[model samples]
Target: MGRQRPPRLPPRKMTGSLPTVILAGCGYGAIDALRALKGQARVIAINPYPYIVNSGMSTRLLSGRFSLDLVRIPLLEHIHTNGAEYVQGRVTQIQPEVQTLTVQTELGRRRLAYDYLLVNVGRELRTIAGIHHAFTIRPAEQLLAAQTWIRDCWRRAAQGDPTPGLLTFVVAGGGCTGTELMGELYDLCQEMSATTGIPLTQARWVLINRNRYLATGIAVEKEGQNNRFSRCIETGIRRLGVEIWAECQVKAFGPEQVWLEDGRELLAQTRLWAGGLQVPQWLSECGLPVGPEGSLIVDECLRVKGSERILAMGDCADFAWGSQTRRLPKIGVYAVRQGPIAAQNLLRLIRGQPLIPYRPQATAFVCVTVGNRIAVAKKGWFIWRGYWATVLKNLFDWLYMRNLKPVRWREFFY
Candidate 1:
């Protein structure tokens, strides 16, 4: 099938007297907020792309199991159908003092005024030296290119082109994204080996992590002690014939080498980096109260610190979990939970009603896909893995995208 194109939205005539709620970025939280604000306020969503890519299924897209069309939700059609305006542009500047935004669009720069603003720009992939030569798992579009590159490598290897590192794939991190990617890459290589009649032993797969264990930052506790989720993940990936290099850091990437911080190098033609993530630098310079990692500090009501008319969530906002001042993890589950609350609070703020404080769930479900029809899931201290876990992950993804559809279709399908 051909790649899907986002529909071009015509210039909307601003005729409504309703208060305008501008969503800085149409991420998971912002999209949910947009749905709640429908018909209540004039909503304008500003995003660089006319569609939102679901990052949860991104590895599947890279493995060629999911297509671009399946992972991307076209924003123009849904926003317009829900009584909102969509602006395809990058937010250049935020003049909070004047309650306005300067967006750089295809035509030119445009100044947009709003009564309330919701910032959910999200985070970008962290980069290292010579990162331009390696594939970073972000922008969602880049995964398509990586997929094409893998196919080309397979073709060359099948024809006995004798290219160095032709079947070697190196993943430069053992975080969730990196782990999933390594598993999928291994699966792809094995499939290719079977199809091209090449020996599977000829291919090499490596995962490099700076931490002592895989998924170091993830919270997996059981009875006041850490659980075995990380250990399980490490064992699972290793069983797939992947070399795990713990406590290792990548210094840079050369033409066909992954340079290590310890002065060692690994030769691999295809390199994938999933080191870390960081908020946009522009966010810190926007004069907003920012916390760690330059994420905007948000209060209990999901409002930006000291700003009544501005709210932030998702990876772009540093939201405290409780009185202890621990920030919530930058994940889709938190954003999904915060979306409706943020929208409701925005409406209450406008109506002079008592706003509700957002209290995060005590324990959230976390799941990571390792390979085709294989996954690991955790909730509190309980852990599950294998095909059943993968099923649960797919169900979650399906429900998220299904809810993004118009109400009419949702009701009909139900």
Candidate 2:
């Protein structure tokens, strides 16, 4: 058998006839660009996840309201619609001079050559020691994991196994995500304990953040000072029987407790970290100009600094306007708006036309939900809270998903 070994097969090679445009990541920005580039060239979309999860609806996933399928859009469906190739892999390296990308696939490593590249790998959650003790409301997997954990804890509670901290849920970070998570979780616990003999009142929910004031809520930061909006959010959280610990830093997460910097310990059966988001390390380590947060530094025109063939948008991009000291907020709207501009600029580049600069909208609106049918909207100094705010938030989310999942399946065989 050893002497009768067969000949090895040769590596497959790509024909050099088509110009390739590689869109890395299936985030809001990347998807938009992929749609725009349809029929223009041979597009290759690469993403590690098989589905594109809508972050806006992630909170609802924790509750029993939305199923995983409701929030996930298949990446392959989009690729098929645009007549593009979809590679389920992560980008390992980007060689600018050679215009090639090193991708790590399930089978093995593969090389992709591209005439243009759009990097929108997005950001990852910040973490601390014993982070495994906590759940993060990030991509679909994290949200699903947290959902499972919550259900398991509730089941344990129903079985009279409510150990110390087993019924207590602690949410670290007072940012928009953290605040909303605590609110949504409060509702979930209430629902789970409604008829299970485990009264919701027995369940404890806590929020800890180092920031004296939350960035977005009923209150807006005025001139770097905490104002009434902060109090409003605190009042809402308190009304839900949730405790708030401002200016408190999380030192370490124990198996069943959270240790604070001030030597205080909290019993948390389930801990959720909505602390903050940081750009992926690969962005900075790949020899590109990156900000302190590891996000790619992009110019006004949404082009990556020091390169015209490369561009970055969304949470992965650090873009500033007139004020170089402050960067644009990493929100969905900014990325949505940047998509068209990036597509236009890219098309212009291909046509040897001048690129258009992007001007960020000054006053961005942010809506943070506290509970079902209750939310807060902040726009500059204007702050509003009511059912209408929640409705508006849902509307925005719906509009975004509607634009993303387009049905354009005009196939053309190569």
Candidate 3:
């Protein structure tokens, strides 16, 4: 006897008579927007994960100073406490014409309708050939996996494994993430060497960057066609016994080999990629106008072009300043600054009032932490590097996390 399959259930509608405002991603900007629109509208926050990871402190987590619990903010609890609904699912499709969203959840596929939508899903790591075999810096959770891999390598070295590359680590990309990661990895290796009675020289670390300079994102000053900031950072990193390969690109990654564009191959058991980022394909597929990098094109008021009901911020949004073709850098600080503006604009949109434009700062401040409690900071033509700079960076990160969750003072230290 053949049994009939279970009947397919209809899509569950997730709205009432009240106007709903959907927060597409629970990122920095979305969190602030949720707080602003708490009592003004029926706010619903949707994300695949139940928590949001703090990327600023991700390297601290990798270096074993911060715990996983400390870096993750309880998004579900925060939303429910603020009188908003939380949906644990991935937004598969967005039908702007119908004001409907297709979400894939555990129960089944559900269709949600909203009067307004705010997107800040953030960007995903750009992939290269054989990227699957290497660790990436997006999603923030992969840093934990890399931490575990490092511990395993230390364990093998402690047991006198004669295999080469067991203690070798390679980081591709010299951007903020890759440089910070390399610094933390250097500190981690030093700690492991001290604990395992292995000489630190036995551990190898290499940082590869396609650009001619490291930390290219930082504000640069040209002194006879030379970037002063990059030169300073390069000297600091080299002093830490780490190798820096400039003007190099990683072609592919294997189990223990990294192939370079110049036909050079390097063997390393642990490989990490933090090269670049791109928006999710589904964002462009949803019929919204996107820029070159697949980010939604937002106007001066943070509203999507040609749509009043849609707004976007963060790395998922492409916003250009007045009369400028260059878009703002994809950084958390800019997203934080855009949150309140997005929320206020949403309120004004609902009340049929005039929307305010978001003015991004011309010169943004940036700080990159090196190992041994040292950091480099730059803004416009000013540059600073020292322990005090590290202190300032830590203070900023601590305040940011403390605002999101109740964090203990001890969590910031090892």
Candidate 4:
């Protein structure tokens, strides 16, 4: 993909000036919106973190293949270069009726008023009892912590005291996160075994899924197409000596074992969760039109159903589209695409022009890396796996970051 500058956005030239367009969340979607409407509107971005973690490359972070500083870029620099203000605060409450936001900052709580609002705060992890006992990849910090723990485990195994479960790395979830995690773990363990002389048998890699196969609910077609993709991933993982436990539900977590719903216990100390994502609890409490997952309900134009001035995007939004009003999936790919669309629609409304409806592509592309320079990608009926797939994944990751990089960073790279 070639580098193309975003359309320059100068403030709308109307009879009177408008209030600032406040975008909450500094994820891919929010940043894209900020890029499009940077100079066009008085834009302010509110996010708890100071950096935007490139989750596309986060899987490599697990295996110590990539560093955090490389994947996570400072949002302040990006916002400043794009001619926008970055608010280092978390939005505690949103009052759409008064168009005021209660933000929690270092100087205590402050109320911010905005003419238009964009909610892309995204989802929170669906936690369970003893979830703290497991490692998660949502926050970039968690990945750093996991890296330390994994290295320590490898060292311990080298000393002949490969603690139970510590060597048996278990990833719970069959989705993209789980699949990528398994691949990275496979390579990590294999490299550690070869370097430290730890037997591969001593180090266990397991993937537990409630469903019978992996990538269960993606754009996979029926008539065993899902199984075909599942088999492809299964082959890739198993070839790397990974164990797959299907149709099994994790009941609870323990320090040294994972209890199963079927009265079975898996001996493993390390558990990585990549399943069950839910929107923030505050979204539903704020009296907005939220869906079952606590995501704000948005119309085809990506506008919040009840309030025209307020819009929602990314994983934080439950969008209804087309005649059937089908709900879209919560994927980073969609979030990146929706950013400019939402920005355009907002600009159209500001200019008194008709808002265009967002129509998602019928087939969503998805890929999972399978250790040792291999990956599996699915686009409609076509499925590719091997070295070429891995090359595609790397190119895609570079393009994703390249498109979202700040002006200064883009200058340094390009």
Give the worst 10-residue stretch by lDDT in candidate 3: 1-10
TM-score of 2: 0.87
For residues 314-408, write the lDDT of model 1, one tens digit per residue.
Answer: 89988875445666778778888988888887777656566677877887778777765578888887888888887777777787887775322
Most accurate candidate by TM-score = 3
lDDT of 3 by residue, 1-414 (tens): 112222222322445455789998877877777778878888989998989887777867667767788888888877887799989988878899999898889999889998889987887778899998788886676878888889889989899887789999999999888998988888888888888888988888999999998878543234422277777778778878989999999999997899999999999999989887778889999888999888999887888877768899998998875443557778887888999999998777666667778888766768887777788877767778888887788778788888888988666643
lDDT of each: 0.80, 0.75, 0.82, 0.77
Candidate 4: TM-score? 0.89
Can you tell me which runs of candidate 4 are displaced by over 4 Å?
1-17, 220-224, 406-414
CA deviation > 4 Å runs, candidate 2: 1-16, 216-228, 323-325, 406-414
Q: What order do you get sorting by TM-score, best first?
A: 3, 1, 4, 2
Weakest ten-residue segment in model 1 by summed lDDT: 1-10
Runs of candidate 3 with Cα error greater than 4 angstroms are 1-16, 218-226
Off by over 4 Å in 1: 1-16, 220-227, 406-414
Steric clash pairs (candidate 3) = none
Model 2: ten consecutive residues of lowest lDDT: 1-10
Comparing 1 with 4 on lDDT, the higher-scoring candidate is: 1
Question: For residues 277-382, could you state the per-residue lDDT of candidate 4 as single tens digits?
Answer: 7777888878789887788988777888788678888888987655556677787777878887888876765655666666678777778888886889888788
For model 3, the local distance difference test gives: 0.82
Per-candidate TM-scores read: 0.90, 0.87, 0.91, 0.89
